[model samples]
Target: MRVLKFGGTSVANAERFLRVADILESNARQGQVATVLSAPAKITNHLVAMIEKTIGGQDALPNISDAERIFAELLQGLAEAQPGFPLVQLKAFVEQEFAQIKHVLHGISLLGQCPDSINAALICRGEKLSIAIMAGLLEARGHHVTVIDPVEKLLAVGHYLESTVDIAESTRRIAASKIPSDPYDPDGGFTAGNEKGELVVLGRNGSDYSAAVLAACLRADCCEIWTDVDGVYTCDPRQVPDARLLKSMSYQEAMELSYFGAKVLHPRTISPIAQFQIPCLIKNTGNPQAPGTLIGASTDEDGLPVKGISNLNNMAMFSVSGPGMKGMVGMAARVFAAMSRNGISVVLITQSSSEYSISFCVPQGDCLRARRALEEEFYLELKEELLEPLSIQERLAVISVVGDGMRTLRGISAKFFAALARANINIVAIAQGSSERSISVVVDNDDATTGVRVVHQMLFNTDQVIELFLIGVGGVGGALLEQVKRQQEWLKKKHIDLRVCGIANSKALLTNVHGLNLENWQAELNEAKEPFNLGASDPSGERVSPAEPGDCRLYLEPGGCRSVRGLPARRLPCGHTEQKGQHLVDGLLSPAASGGEQIASQVPVRYQRGGGAAGYRKPAEPAERGRRTATFLRHSLRFAVLYFR
Candidate 1:
């Protein structure tokens, strides 16, 4: 069996979902198949935010109701957009899921009780809702789908969305699960469909697990993951004009790529699928005819150990150091135990075997928690450890390159060093594991765009280029876009190519990686005629597109507005528009603004309204003579003037 997994983006909406169905149908023609699903695009992040809000003291009960509304609308919108789909029936099923979660959240909020376990349950709902809808849609398409939930086979914690697979037990359980052929029957086949329906997500890249878990149980030949981007590029194509894709990669290589922030595949996915030696395909929805990047166990390459470049942004660096009990054996355990107790998960970590000091990473959001945990538990070690209890940094970015070829190759780092040097970028921190499939580094986020582009430039050769589907077109976002558009010609002329992939308003979305024509953006926007969704409340609430130091190119123009909904159209940072005085006059001159009122009703001016007239100035001597003549004429005309008056 070939297992195909479509990510949140691949099945985000009705159209993409339909596209996914088509992909499945095509794949089925080759062999027996199954597909794993992720939550709709961006849904997880929003759900995460809601959890954060609850932690910050917002009543999640009402928010759950609000989320349900959003879900229902998006689902209906997608259904209506896709043709030849039985979405009417599908809509009710999805709505029911929305109601279930909303009901639970409402109950929790009313109780004013927010606990880690409760929050994880709430967070996992998005994926549950997504998978349920997907399985239903697949069934509607006449495909046999056995939907599974982690709660059934995978042992998990109530406080965390992730569950560690009891490899042998879960595998045996999955293999034994059965599916009911009848569409209406609730009983289902060789999956968790019949067990606990509540979802228990795997860590960070849990959806990958849903696929791997199923794949491992079935011993499938391959697992195919569908996403928005084409197979892995040499780098982020936007920065480097020529980031190309390697046709195939070994499992070790894929794992390294993923670990270093490539995001091509999930790390845990490797342990399950790799152990079974099942190959995986990274495919893109836009181009089915194209052969995607194949990741398998076989590793045989004579050249080019490095395959692709990846990056992670918005990272925080946290370090704890002290000289307390240098000979202590439990020092490390105590520090970590405290963080775990506080429910703060540490990410990247490094330590000296000497046990004199320790440093690690946590998501920026959890920094405060990590700090508090350390201060509370290691109060004595605080003085012994060092002068400072905590050190932190925000605005850092991480970049990595993965390749099995690197193991046998020397001078790999030379190329990277030279590329970064040529670009005048600095590397903040470096970490590499013994596997040698990947090289990782930390850098300032400010250098992220430039840094990634430079690596891409040094790596790949491609005619097809990067595309960005920008959502918020506010100040900085708007400025950067305009700058990109304006400089697009220059970039293309210099052999660099990029396009605006898509633009979404609050309610509408328009995209074509070939790029929507810049000159007629407004006309195109009006023609697309999609519903627009923009409001006072966006996640950033900054709702304003960022305009910062690098955004000078966008703002040279005196007036411009982001294309986001509710924003008034304005000029780009670099462009020139009519001055305010003239612009104001033009507005007042407008028939609509003027209410068809005549200009004579408005104000006085030297010139008459539409009156044919000429203006002239006499010379100085002639003007004096004319004044004397006017005075004499007035005196002589006194009698006639009096009579006229």
Candidate 2:
């Protein structure tokens, strides 16, 4: 059995829906196949709008007859696309479904309360209409004709539309149910067993869940998910210049990738199917024949193929802990429970027993809440005695390469770091899971996208990833940042990862460890004032920022030291110098800042009389006499002088 799920985009409109029918025909010919589908893209939103409007006392109510007419019109369009399906016949069936929905909506509008059941009932109509239309087209094409509402036979939703599966019984009943009716004419009816039924309204994106559930229910050899993209990309191609498609990934990798940001599959939808060891094929709806990504238990034969690239940016990663929490199992539970209650999602989590810390990342939007929760709960612990105050940093991003092949490759980590090093980006946080299938890094949010692409380059890039880091952010630092931001578009176009991780001043610092906004970093720096002492750690050394001779002295290093750099010792014009007992007149210049120049000086060279290697003679009468003075280098090190009258 083959179960196919067509997302909204795959069956977005009549044209796309017709294409969906054709793909199903091809599958049906091979063997028995069933399909799960989502609402046509705009219909659900439109339905929601109508519901909202009616609730708001707007005069847009489509009474029974009017709704029936609209549904008929929608169906007529579906039938027109497929040859020989009488447009009139399809329209009648659509009228009936819409009539049922209208009666429900009218009841809802009258009551001014759209209950969860009413909402699901209305929303599910789009899929119902599409399937009815598609099924008719399939029958006209001479395939086995049957249509089933997940709500009627396969699904039994609860009070609020939550889905739960009692599969053993649900399957037994589907196996025993009567010949399913041609869904095109629902009045024709079909028999469904009593115990084999439970409401399984797939959640939003639940179509994928529905498809997998059906595949597992049928004990099918495989399931296919058809969607818009070719397959999962290692990174979002739009954001990363070098994002690559991951042709195949293990069940675990697929889950991990989706959890990060790979959108091809749902995060939890894969586990149930994987439990059955069912292989899932991800095929593009646009190119139906192309073998897309596949998920299975078996490892890849080509050495772990790049599974996919994924990243989460603008994140704040924190590791909060104290010795009190060390080796304490419930500490994580307490912290995570608190986060969960506040509706905060921690995307990645890891812990160190020795360090007694648990670090995870939350979306920037929730960083404040997460920070507040931890600080409030662990405040006294951190300030009064322990180290559990929480070490939180925002403006961060996480990029990870997930593949099971990591287990076999001894130096995979090496290559991962090398690629970013070539690009000159830094790794702020690094974690390796116990499974070792993937390694993730927390970097400046600005470089998040670059970090993913650079790793992609190392793993699959034709050209290696080179990175640069820019430190100084003042006059020259300002100019340098502007230049980087302006040239960044061109640089990315050229595949140069010019990363500006952290920009510092004397008080606060702003970083894009992922890479700065090449377009507006100057203003960003002007508003920032973080003091920093530079560190010389090179992760990817390609260069986020190139050092200007002047930039090196100012921007290259983090903070300016009070003592000036490269200053020459000076004596007073009055021949005054520090005596041993007197305070020394030390002459040193402060380190170079945004702008500067050397002081004025015009010391003359003079020679002293020399004879048979004897010491140079002093000025004629007195060194301070009112006469001309001549000086010469005696030992070629210092000048000796004589006064001439």
Candidate with best lDDT? 2
lDDT of residue 595 for candidate 2 = 23
Candidate 2 residue-wise lDDT, 1-645, digit = tens: 677888878877667777888787677667777777776666666676767777787765554334444455556666676677757776776667766766776787789978765675666677777676666677777666666545445543333344554456556656777545332212101111123343324445667776776777778788888899877666676655456666677888888888777777877578768989999988889988777878888857345545666787788888887787765567778788879777788877777758577889999999889888877766667687666457888898888878887777788888887766644467887877888887888788756654665566567654312222334444444544455555555645654434555455544446542455767666776776544322222222222232322212211111011122232222223221212102110111122122222111111221212121112122222132211111111101111111110
Per-residue lDDT of 249-315 in model 1, one digit per residue for the tens?
A: 7887777667656666777677788888888878888777778887787744324567878877777
Q: Compute the lDDT for candidate 1.
A: 0.57
At residue 403, candidate 2 shows an lDDT of: 82
Q: Residue 105's C-alpha lDDT in candidate 2?
A: 65
